[model samples]
Target: MELDYVVGQTLAWLRALGIEKDTFVFFTSDNGAARVSDVPVPGGGSNGPFLCGKETTFEGGMREPAVTWWPEHIPAGTVSQQLGTVMDLFSTSLSVAGFSVPDDRLIDGLDLSPVLHNNTLINRPIFYYRGNGIMAVRVGLYKAHYWTWSNSWEEFNQGINFCPGQEVAGVTTHTQQEHTMQPLIFHLGWGPWEKYPISAVTTEYQDALSRITAVVEKHKKGLVPGVPQLNMCDMTWLS
Candidate 1:
C-alpha cells in the first residue's frame, strides 16, 4: 500500500509537469530484502520463496521485482517476463534519451528496447558478483552457482528461533561452508522454493553453462587495468 501511494504521487507529479507522456519511469531495487535490518539472514525481512537473502548469490539476493512505465511507448498493462539486470538500466535509459554510449569504455549493459517494446525474449546472461569475485551466472532461465554459503541465520537456527507458522523449520538453516569445485545448477523459472539441481540430468545445462562462461570470459578480457576515473581525479589521491 505504501509503494502504491508513492507510485501515485510520482505519476501525479509527472502529470502536473505536463511531461507524463514524454517521461519514462522505472521502479526497481538493487537487491533482495535483508533477513535482519542490521544483521544477516533469518532476522526480519522476507524474500518469499526465494532462497537466502542479501549478501549471497541466490536469486533471492539478486533477482529483484521491477515495474516500468512509458505512457504510449510501453503498452498499457503490458507485462514482460524478459530477463535483465540493474546494469541494463544505463544502456536502456541512454537509448530512450537518444544518446550514444561512449565506445572507449567497456559497458556491461545492453539496450533493452526490443525486450520492452516488442516483448522479445533475449538470451542475456547475467553474472552474479560478490565483492570482486563472480559467484554465479544465469543464462536464460538456468543458473549455475559456482560458489554458495549458508546466507541466513535461520538456516542454522535448528528450530530454536523460528516463529510459529513460519514456512521453514529451524533445522532447515545451515552453517556457512566453502565453495565446491563443481557448480550447482537450478532452473529458476521453476521457482526457487524447489532446490532441485537440474544440471546432472539435463543436456541443455552444459550448453547454458558454456555460453555463460564465454560471456564472463569476454567481459574479463575487456577490462582496463587502472583505478576508477572518479578515483583517479580525486584531490586526495593526487596528494
Candidate 2:
C-alpha cells in the first residue's frame, strides 16, 4: 500500500507538471521475496510457484515481474515474454533518450527498445550468477543448472526454509553441488515450478545441453574478472 501510494503520487506529480505522457516509468523488484518463515499463505511472504527465494539461483529467487509505463509510446495492455535482465535497463534508458551506449568497454546489456515498442520476442541466453560462479543459464524455455544450492543448513536448522515443502531430492540442496559434468536441465514450458528435470539420456536433453554448453564456453572465453567489492571495508575511520 505504501509503495502504491508513492507511485501514485509520482504519477500525479508528473501529470501536474504536464509531463505525464512524456515520462517513462519502469517498476520492478530486484529479486524474489526473502521468505523468512514457513508459515502458510497470508502469514509469511511468498515467491509464488517458483522454488526458494532471494539469495538462491532458483527461478523464485531470480525471476521478477517488470512493469513499464509510457502513455503514448508503449501500448496499453501489451505484454512481452522476452527474457530481460536489470542490466538491460541501462541500455533501454539510453535508447529511450535517443542516445547510443558507449562502445569503449564491455557492456553486457542489450537495448530492449524492440521488445518494449513492438512486443517483439528477442531470443537471448540469460546467465544466472551467484557471486563469481555461474550457477545456471537459460536459453529459451530450457534452463540448465550447473550448480544448485540454497540457504545454508545452518539457516535451515534455525527453521528458515526458503523452499519450504518444495525441495527436490537431488537438485536443491543446502551446500553447493556441481552438475557441470551433467547439468540438470528443465523444460520450463511444461513445468515453470521446476518440479521435473529432463532425463540426461533423452535426445532433448542432449540437444539443449549442446546449445547451452556452447553459449557458456563462449561467454567464459571473453570474460574479465572484476575486483571484489563485498570484502572491502574500512572500520579504522570509525575508530
Give all TM-scores, in the order shown. Answer: 0.78, 0.93
Per-residue lDDT tens digits for candidate 2, residues 208-239, read 99999999999999898777655537565445
Give, for candidate 2, the lowest lDDT window spanning 10 residues: 35-44
Model 2, residue 215: what's the lDDT? 90
- List model 1 lDDT by residue over 55-125, tens digit each: 55676667788899889899888888787888899999998888987789878788998877898878787
Question: lDDT of candidate 2 vs native?
Answer: 0.87
Residue pairs with clashing backbones, model 2? none
Model 2: lDDT of residue 159: 88
Query: Which portions of model 2 show Cα errors greater than 4 Å?
Result: 38-43, 229-231, 236-239
Clash counts per candidate, in order, are 5, 0
Error of 1 at 213 (Å): 2.8
